[model samples]
Target: MFKPAEGPVRLPSGQRYLGLDLGSKTIGLALSDTGHRIASPYQTLARKKFSADAAELQRIVAKEGVAALVLGLPVNMDGTEGPRCQATRAFARNISQLMPLPIALWDERMSTMAVQRMMTDEADLSRARRAELVDKLAASYILQSYLDWVGGQPT
Candidate 1:
């Protein structure tokens, strides 16, 4: 189902969408319901390689009936794009070639830092536990933000 996209994905109702926090060594995953109202942490995929990661994600997308992707774009704080942003865009391009679904890049500035702060200050989690939860939690944060924006937009 790897369809090429012209731009960012426009999410439709009654279809699940997967959110991703793509790290160099791991990929965090979150899933929105058919209604696209609630998003929850789905999994943290350990990166072995691009093809393998995409294949696993493809399987999950098919299994979950996911209609699109919401990828966290790591933008810089000064409202400027940097190497990480460029790398993410390239990753999106490569992934777009592999999957037909639209990949929306959500501004993910401080998503990880926010997640870490929440885990440490609010959850009172240990460093090891925080390490385990941060990625997926960050993915959830990204998805939730996107869902809120989508809900706010006029139909």
Candidate 2:
């Protein structure tokens, strides 16, 4: 049986990390700098079977030299885990078994909402465009929050 990978090795110079926002229909992706200071939306992956998704993620990990993965944990406003959060955890567990990468779950409450608002208010994007881009933007938001928290900054 395959065991899950251990936690990430702390680097002298923090290595680049990947962030994921796992949705029912799509998966949002983000990448952080080696310095772990900034995170940017990388792309959105249309949801597919677990095996295929894992293969694609493995490719990204190999190509990007990713040191760890930050998974967004969806939570209710009351700070409780919900069905979505459980789903995200299951995804992470399975991915860890395959890739053995260090993974941490970050709170993602309001991330999607914040991204939608940003698209509407700043970009003035229409609903359709916002819908198309919100997942990746939410991934970015989740990653940025994690980075901030890990670096001892307020999220």
What is candidate 1's lDDT per residue for 4-102, written digit by digit as tens?
Answer: 344445666767889999998899999998888899999999998789988999999999999899989899898899988887788788888887777
**Superposed Cα deviation of residue 111, candidate 2 (Å):** 0.4
* Model 2 TM-score on a 0 to 1 scale: 0.89
Worst 10 residues of 1 by lDDT: 1-10
lDDT of 2 at 60: 92
* Residue lDDT tens for model 2, 1-155: 32333443233455778889999999999998888889999999999999999999999988887988888888999998889988988898788888877788887989999998889999999888888888888998998888777777333
What TM-score does candidate 1 reach?
0.92
TM-score of each: 0.92, 0.89
RMSD of 1: 2.5
In model 1, which regions exceed 4 Å deviation? 1-10
The local lDDT score (0 to 100) that residue 62 gets in candidate 2 is 89
